[model samples]
Target: MRPVPDRRLWLLVLGFSVWGSALGFVYVLHSVGCAFAWPANAIRLGLGLVLFVHLALVGLLWRSYAGTYPGAPAVDPTDSFLNWVILWTLIAAFVTIVFTLGPTLLLTTCT
Candidate 1:
């Protein structure tokens, strides 16, 4: 089995991966909603729902972030650093989604 320290290394990519996926998904969703000539409220509602779900998923990722499992031998300081990096990366991703796509929820795009 891979060393525990390196097991979580793959998580480094998770934060921005989610953010980028959300960015593309939000853009496409909004575009489609506008193209369909959907009602203003309906479009915004859809946007709101998507944003909510994305945020929730990111929150879940935050809850799941861990650089080292408990009960295992303590790793070097890099493990704690990894923990902080994961925490902040997720935070940044969450904030980026909120500040960028969240505004569309409060405003109409199909009107």
Candidate 2:
């Protein structure tokens, strides 16, 4: 059985990391915009643009390495589990960003 390496494990969390970064960045953007009294349209546009960037990031991560790591060989239980976890994390991160952050677009900002 091929044992999963410790160092490579970090790849599993990459999806969540990107999502978290996006969340923090967007929060900062909103706070700054509100503090500066940015017009409603500008704030909304900024948020939308940031969200688009995050979504694109998550998409790239998923596309590049969701499952089946590079140079991986025959099936092994540990490798299989790791691959599944990585895939789900990416999926969950994508769904979460959409569901949680999407509503902000519809509602009034800085309310």
Per-candidate TM vs. native? 0.79, 0.85
Clashes of each: 0, 0
Across residues 1-111, which tens digit of lDDT does each residue of candidate 2 receive? 776899879988888888888789779988999999999889889989988999999998887665575346675778777777887789899988998888777887885
At residue 1, candidate 1 shows an lDDT of 25
**Each prediction's Cα lDDT score?**
0.77, 0.83
Q: State model 1's lDDT.
A: 0.77
Q: Write the per-residue lDDT of candidate 1 for residues 55-77, one digit (tens) a residue.
A: 88889888876434333366556
What are the candidates' C-alpha RMSDs?
3.7, 2.7
Lowest summed lDDT window (length 10), candidate 2 = 64-73
